[model samples]
Target: MYTTLLENIPMLFNDPTRDFVAGIIDAEGNLQILKKGSIRLVVVNTNVTILSAVRRVLADIGIEIAIRPYGKPKGNERQRYRVVIYGRGNVEKVLKVIPLQHPKFFSIPLFSSPSWGRKSGNERDPRPQLLPPPPGGGHIGGTAAV
Candidate 1:
């Protein structure tokens, strides 16, 4: 019976193109809202190490993830987890890898992300400034090229 239900669950939502990826990051908050008639999953942690450990477990379960690791808006220092799965029994399987100590779960939704962008510090160097416009047709300081 479970297999039949699982097969019918429609894995299409896991596709990377869908907006649902956002819900996975805000999974904690949006899980309830998105899961109105759908399956929900949650992976919880405030520590980077713990969160990473959870993600690795998911990877091992054959679910390739596109992670958007960043600090919470409230400045609570908790990193968020948002990803997509590529295989079956993912929710059930990932739960097996995570040790019972760390409270993260699949099959139940949680707060996730709406888009993917690396955190500020993690971005490339910001030291170099953009080159000024070309000497000819391009204007500078709001003055027409003279």
Candidate 2:
């Protein structure tokens, strides 16, 4: 549905389009904490057109992003591109404009916290403390290397 719409016409920054982009993010996006403790939102797809449309929608909301080739394509596979929202401020901006309904939703507060990557001691903390697991002791998400 999104591919068809995105390929046919440009997307507006209206509420419906925002929700549509949110759905795309929820399905294809990853909210990640890089090794340096910076946060990013990434959506990967084989279709550059769709990713470009997504980028336009995000730009309308005053958030900047970059579309880059992800990696080498496997045999018989299309090259993947990533629409990335880098840095704490951009990630926060996306969260404010789009309500994400996914486990990634829990990452917003943690990513927005001022002390997210700060060291509490004299030594540089190798692994910043993340939010504790949920009440039932389930995993939240994984961190990505830089």
The candidate that wins on TM-score is 2
> Worst 10-residue stretch by lDDT in candidate 1?
29-38
- Candidate with the greatest lDDT versus the true structure: 2
Clash list (residue pairs), candidate 2 = none
* lDDT (Cα, tens digit) per residue for candidate 2, span 34-105: 544566778888877777767878888888778899999899999988887886667767866787788765
Candidate 1: tens digits of C-alpha lDDT, residues 1-146: 99985774344233222222222333332112121222224434344443344355455556655545544656554455444332224433433332332222322222122122345757733222222222332321122222
Superposed by TM-score, candidate 2 places the C-alpha of residue 132 at a distance from the truth, in angstroms, of: 13
All candidates: CA RMSD (Å): 20.3, 9.2
Instruction: List lDDT for all candidates, in order.
Output: 0.35, 0.67
Q: Candidate 2: where is the Cα deviation over 4 Å?
A: 1-16, 107-143
Model 1: residues with Cα > 4 Å off, grouped in runs: 1-36, 69-71, 75-88, 95-146
Clashes of each: 18, 0
